[model samples]
Target: MKKDKNRYTVFEHEALYVHRGEQKLSDAQLKAFQLFYKERDFPYYSLVHNGIRFCEYVGVIKVGNLTIEVLPKADKSNGEEHWRSILIDMMRSTGLFHPDSPSYSSLKVKNSTILDMYLELFATEVERLMHQGLIKKYRKTQSNSTALKGKLLIGKQVTLNAVHQEHFYIEHTVYDKEHLLHQILSKALTTVVKIGTASHLISRYKRVLLDFPEQRDIKVNESLFDKIKYDRKSQSYQTAVDIAKIILLNFHPDLSQGSSHVLALMFDMNALWEKFVLRSLQRNAPDGLEVSGQVSKDFWTPETGYTKKIRPDIVIRKNNEAVAVLDTKWKNIGDANPSDDDLRQLYAYSRYHNNVPSYLVYPGNENKSLSGMYSRAFVGDAQTPGGVIKLKVHSGKRDGMELLNQNISAILF
Candidate 1:
């Protein structure tokens, strides 16, 4: 990184005194003075006389005298502009700025854009803080009244009465600064990984597809298929499948009999998770593999005002056939296995995609035994298909890319 000379006072002094000002001094003397100044503040008279020469040597500000420098102290407004510029640069460095055409100009910096960039950088933390109820809003009001009578007015010219009232309120939420800062840092990290992984997958797929277009086809004869399936030409397909599986595993909701609360949380997480997954697939999937997110299809239903609209998280297609339908849920899956709701949703996805095999993925517990639950549920039962399979995602302990690799391997192979 280039040093920001303007940031330091010594450089500023040197620029002002030696370069911009008419201060005259021998090179050796100037060097000696600078060295002395580094140890302690320059005496007022020496600075006054030599400040110009000193600044010229340093190459920052032009110094006129001890009391005055050509470079004035940054005023509040100028300082604000400088801070804003720094923030814009930060945004550009963080990939928030457009590479092709710069969004920031030399003149005015967009306040809204700056704010949005800050929010994006700190959304996760902000959201977490909000969830903890660390921020709150309230309101207040006031009123007054009086009374009157017709008899009073008549009596005396009588008695009389009157009334008056007033009301007002103000409201806003206060945020915990410490908690907000912590959350922002945490979320920023998570956003980077999520974004980076997606980008990598997309780039990888684009390269493979460009290299081998033939591998994009979904339907292939058994003999030729096995030969090219694991070859370099098929790398894009493999990557797409892998990325999709990982997304499904991390984002899928857990389903159990009559558990509305867990299901709701699962749905919320799935919304974000699926979006990331779709973006990744789009970035990396070969042209042959048609990857789409939240695809909506409508069919007439029993109700007059309602139509059956199906939106699948991911639909991976090869040729005309919908090869796979993947739905992500954030719910934790237990040993008890797939519930009726789980089966029903997958079945719906399959039906919507013309009987395609649908996968429902959820997070799995690390130290728990799922075998016992499976055995109990399958006692004396033959291998009955058309049910959801439970996949455990140990995202908390493992690398995201590695976890995704495992998911893709399971999905494709």
Candidate 2:
């Protein structure tokens, strides 16, 4: 099948209607997605009548022969291609799965999908690591050795080597490239080869796998990635490992659905939006002002349980004093009043942060920043703390980062 024939593109919160026996999802594929939703427990999409409505999560979800690409949407009128590029740029800004400089141009020129880009990135990392030489680590081996290079187990030697005196049963340590990190990367390369649809990416992955050192295949899990510790020797493999983690962890093979595999490279739009804004602010912050994210404050303490903490999305400080608090929303609220819950949340954040000005940031058609004040700080208090809650809107155009940087400049300076 042709690429366009099999690919279905939809925006976030948009519905992709499933046809019974047409160009859309088949019954088996729909069942596969249903099983994925049930098993993964992540609300990537919700089941509608004869359709799958994608939520805030955006990325590629490959089910059998159909490739569904869900891209983020702040403006409902924008087409798929525009949002695709914006999504790529946003992912790059947030240090998510993005290709290196060399591979990036080729991918862009070829107009590759998210999966293709990720696979290309992984392959590029593997190629770079191979050129730099794979790191070797000390691994213990238990075998019969002709040369006594390591410790000899007396009991094993006595029992196993009784017949053959020429061979000694020993436990020895040897430095080699076969380790957890390499094994994980190797597994990811294999996965990329399996689920990857792009011919170029598949070939590249295969070539890298050929050059990659032979590693003992192990069952990869979330815990295995946690065990990887990068030192000076293995520091260069961090990007490859991170991409590999994303690939291997998200790739799920459905046995009940037969040969269909579900690979969902989805990101929470809310979190990504917050991170992008935070990174933009951090990069463009002025002198004597610091920008931090997920700054926590103890909101409540229970006598028998853990204390509840409130974390603002982005908090700005000057000389360790809370100057401003920004809460980012990925949704577009045009010309309408802000939600009461959001306003109240910002109010709470302001009250906790010593009455600092808190802003509710959103993506809008144009740059609009408005300042408003709470008439009274509390219901009972007659006096107001004079804490202001501002609304800052970023024009989510192609130059969104630049616009966001400008917004940050205006707030910080």
lDDT of all predictions: 0.37, 0.77
lDDT of 2 by residue, 270-376 (tens): 99889988898898888888999998889999999999999999899999998888888888888776889888898788788877777888876666666677666
Over the stretch 178-201, how does candidate 1's per-residue lDDT look in tens digits?
322222233333322333322323
Pick the lDDT winner. Answer: 2
Where model 1 places Cα greater than 4 Å from the true spot, the runs are 1-267, 280-287, 366-402
**Model 1: lowest-lDDT 10 consecutive positions:** 258-267
Best by TM-score, which number? 2
State in Å the error of residue 193, model 2. Answer: 1.9
Output the TM-score of candidate 1.
Answer: 0.32
